[model samples]
Target chain A: MLPTLPLGPFIFPTAGLVIIFGAWFCLWVIEKAALRLQLDAQATYTLAVVGLFAGFLGARLAFVALHWPAYQQNLIGILWPLTSGYAPLGGLATGIVAAFFYGRARQLPFAATLDALTPGLILGLMVISLADFLGGPGYGTLTAVPWGLSQYGVRRHPVQLYELLAGALTLLVWWRLVRGRRYDGQLFLTAVAVYSATRLFLDAFRDNTWIITNGYHGWQLVAFAALLLSLLLLARHDGNQ
Target chain B: MLRTRFEWVILIIVATLLGSAWIMMSQEPATAGSSLLTLAEAPIVGHPAPNFTLPGTVGQEVSLHDLAGQPVVLNFWATWCAPCRVEMPAFQQASVQYNGRAAIIGINQGEAAKNVTDFGAEYRITYPLLLDTDQQISRLYEVRGLPTTLFIDADGVVREVVIGAITPAVLQDRIERLLAEAGNP
Candidate 1:
């Protein structure tokens, strides 16, 4: 069983700390990248702040839309600060939108700024997966595999950790691409392709309560479409920048 | 970027009004307005039970309206709810003891059906169990707490609602009273 910290009667989640540190660390890394890229550090900081807030709202909105019945009676409780129900894909989508819009407002080149932010996004994902592993929510399928972990009560695959490892591997690929400057926008495309591919496999192990349509887990369908779209966009945009 | 002092004051006033309105609408109620309202002010009892049809255990079809002729006891439970496990044996005993006098329906909320089946094996609860995997019934009942039970009369009016572990005695007595009221022998 995972140990939870308590403040009086209420338990303060350790995963919450992990999330805070993850966001902070990502912003710090992005700030450094901004300095190196000769972009406005203040503007980068502002964009990060905006992304955090907007991403949180967007994630909650998506969760609510999917699970509206859960929130019908206690809409106030759903919006409470400590309540947890974030969609990582939703958050990433919103963060990317915020970053793009903020970049435009700040007169930053969208593609180059995306490249600069790639490493930070990878770090953010690593921390998210790690935090989810500690949290009880994102448990995986029961497996006879030797590496499977027992979470809450049952033995299951550590799919969150698998995701973390995949993220780290993607980060390494992004780092190499950024350092070598082999191809422009390669880091961003790789991030999308790699994460989507990883998600497609990882969701097979994830214990999802709701299957919306076509025997596909809700997120898996999103990941599949995303992978296709990312591949198509990369093919179209590559070498043209 | 420069604004006149009057314009700034008006802007500040408008912002304050909007902020206050937002806060008022977003906050949960602190007090009840009527006798039916409890401390939570939630509609747990005396409201019409929301009708739902879920796939019952053993491939049986279960519907809320199907149990309308008899007093129905709707229990919202899950494999993961600790209190639900604690209360299951009591419900099982009550259901068996009551026999045809009442219907005990356990609606499994937000869990895999296999997990629920395993849990049922452990608890040995012999009642009509419905699989509410998407939490449709849970939402209908406005269930904020686990192990919630609704006592519906023969006429399909919800008589009482219990939010926690209920003893077999209290449940049996409630069912008996409802049955007697309905002129059942």
Candidate 2:
């Protein structure tokens, strides 16, 4: 795994580079989608920027709070070192909340705004999956298949690639939904449903998923709930149409 | 304008495909080889141990290159690893058994110095325990698992790499071979 990329006297974490690039691409995609939909592109861009900052700050602050006692003892440790302690759930929660507030403050249509953002979100996920594959996180279960990638002295299924393929397919589905317009929020709901269903199916191959008792993964349950919610929204919107 | 939108969509899709292809091509060859072959090709064994100066638990900077004439057992471990806990006593025994001839250096991976010192004292470990705060040395060694032991001869060439919990007999056996190699060389 290429954990760090070295460029003549400086080394940067490859995953951080991928995430930053992905965020930039995500913002660009959202702007183009907003323009295509004849929506307020400037407001959407502002909201995306706000959401990204909130997510990053929220994740870092949550990590610091969790290790508050340690930081309290050594202020230098808290100030100087940037360790891998950010929580993904905290970041996701903060990003969603920040986007909601930004939309409300800008007087933007929530459904249409989300529809414009779907492609960027899927593409961002695709980039993150690629980063995970390269940086050796969320590794797959042991497999004897010819395509298995060697990790920790064992041939394992490349689940990160599976997630990337799933993200690509979801993006295609979103593209089709956008082309064949039905309702205001149809594209966004369908995108979420496709992505969630993909996660529900592909997460089984992941070795590091948190498994509850009875052989069920926590992420699989979350994906199922998200898929259900999206389908319900789609159904409600179809009835209105 | 509609045609331009379609073109943008096509461009995005094509870029995504190209990016995925590039990532796969770059990663597959490096990780596709057999695990044993990958371990062999790793820049660890048969190469000189990467030199680093780290703060030891005893308030001194310990550098691997400074201890030139003695066989060094560099074990990368963590205080919380169960296998590391199981193997500590064995390493402690081996340290005393080969007092002047070999050096047993325990490199704790990314833990506070206080915790490592407490654990070392609890285990009655007499060897020097160094703190790899940023885990730079661990990354340099490509140590994927805990309790990874590298036996370096007097010439600083890494001779053997042992993963997982090690017994006193096994540690002694490897140290004996390392000492033998050093003397003959």
Maximum-DockQ candidate = 2
Q: Per-residue CA lDDT of candidate 1, range A1-241, in tens?
A: 2324456764545567688889899989888876766667778767877888888888877766665654565566355523445565787699779867987888876666776677787888788788767743465665778888843234678888998888888877776666655455656876877787677656767653235533446666666666666655565544244
- Provide all candidates' interface root-mean-square deviations: 22.6, 14.8
On the 0 to 100 scale, the lDDT of residue B131 in model 1 is 94
TM-score (chain B) for candidate 2 is 0.75
Q: Which pairs of residues collide in candidate 1? A: none
- 10 residues in a row with least lDDT, candidate 1 chain A: A207-216
> Over the stretch B1-185, how does candidate 1's per-residue lDDT look in tens digits?
11255554454455345434433332323331132222122223333466788997678889888877889998998877776776687689878977887899999988887888887777887898889989977876767567777888886767766656654445665787799979994
DockQ in order: 0.02, 0.04
Segments of candidate 2 deviating more than 4 angstroms: A75-79, B1-127, B130-140, B143-185
CA RMSD, predictions in order: 19.8, 14.3
Model 1 spans with C-alpha error above 4 angstroms: A1-3, A6-10, A36-38, A57-98, A151-154, A237-241, B1-185
Give chain A TM for each model in order. 0.78, 0.93
Q: How much is the lDDT of residue A202 in candidate 1?
A: 68
